[model samples]
Target: MERLTLSVTIDRPIGYDHHGTIYPINYGYVAGVIGGDGEAQDVYVLTEDDKPLESFTGELIAVVHRGDDVETKWVVTDFDVSYTADEIMATVRFMEQYFKSTIEMVD
Candidate 1:
């Protein structure tokens, strides 16, 4: 499978919630990678761990293409981890629910 490696700065560590919506995992961005929004590309790190993280390097498994926003959400996981498009959607629904999106599976 083709994979993209991304180094993320974990801003929202596990156990963090914004606006009453709890974060189920780590969420951050590639420090210098720019997205369609003209800023650092944002990322969602999928994991079962509740421990916080300051940074992470993982495989890009999927892309959450938002039809309403200029930016797309990239789904990243452990080097040996795997998650289906459905799983990715389910994990990120808390905030993704606010956007109109389609999951694009990456291999």
Candidate 2:
């Protein structure tokens, strides 16, 4: 398990999935980290709270690698939420299902 401590800011809140599907978690990106997509690394902030945030400093617990997509997403948590690879996949399946993905667990 590779546990990474990093900081991120949330741009997406719990709401519709742009396609009208409800998002159960917050999603955003690390401020300065760049990813394969040439942007700040994308991240999923797994929390049940409805509050939206501009920024959050937290930990990167895993990386979601998509076989069909050009981008990899970092899974981060601002609070005390944790999940196994399987559990994480299930939670983000709403959108991730469109792409073949594997979760690389971190400490």
Candidate 3:
């Protein structure tokens, strides 16, 4: 799969409260990359560390396409590991459940 090195700035950390929806994982964005929403590209960093993080440098493994929204979230991992689409979905469901999303593994 195609992988890109990205330096993500974690804006929303684990347990972050957003309108009563607690974040279960690290949610960040690539510093200079603008996404479909015209902002920093949002990313979901999948890592072994469960605690909150300030920033992460990792590989972009997949892209989450939201049919209902213009923003597409990317999945990144710091460890030398790969995650199936199902696994990625399950990990991000905490927030993705609100959108019609599909994961495209990088190739």
Candidate 4:
């Protein structure tokens, strides 16, 4: 089945801190045509330091068949103290690719 992949650039780090430890947060917004069929699915995956925290998989965040039109937004606190837009985008891209690859492997 063919999958649709979309990419976006983020300029800020999305993370949060608890107690005295800081966590690196990562997230992805995915929407695509399902196997060229008329059905579509939107999904969101949020993580803390490469671990899955929460996810909306196999369905759209808002609607099931409206996956292709789904949108995702994420916020992270306490990223690196010196991160820049370029660095954040690079990190987001890496996480997005990793998530996509992992999902494909599991399918």
Instruction: Output the number of the lDDT-best candidate.
Output: 3
Residue 25 C-alpha lDDT in model 3:
93
* Order of models, best TM-score first: 3, 1, 2, 4
The lDDT of each candidate is 0.87, 0.81, 0.93, 0.31
On TM-score, the candidate that comes out on top is 3
TM-score of each: 0.91, 0.85, 0.96, 0.24
Off by over 4 Å in 3: none
lDDT of 1 by residue, 2-104 (tens): 6798899999988888878778789999988898999888999986677889999888988889999999988888888888888888899988899999999
Residue 67 accuracy (lDDT) in model 2: 96
- Cα lDDT tens digits for candidate 4, 7-100: 3222222453435433354333333434223433223332234543443222111111223333323222232223333444444453343232
Clashes of 4: 5
**Cα-based lDDT at residue 102, candidate 1:** 90
Superposed on all Cα atoms, the candidates' RMSDs to the truth, in angstroms, are 1.6, 2.0, 1.1, 13.7
Better of 1 and 2 by TM-score: 1
How far out, in Å, is residue 96 in model 4? 4.2
Q: How high is the lDDT of residue 38 in model 1?
A: 96
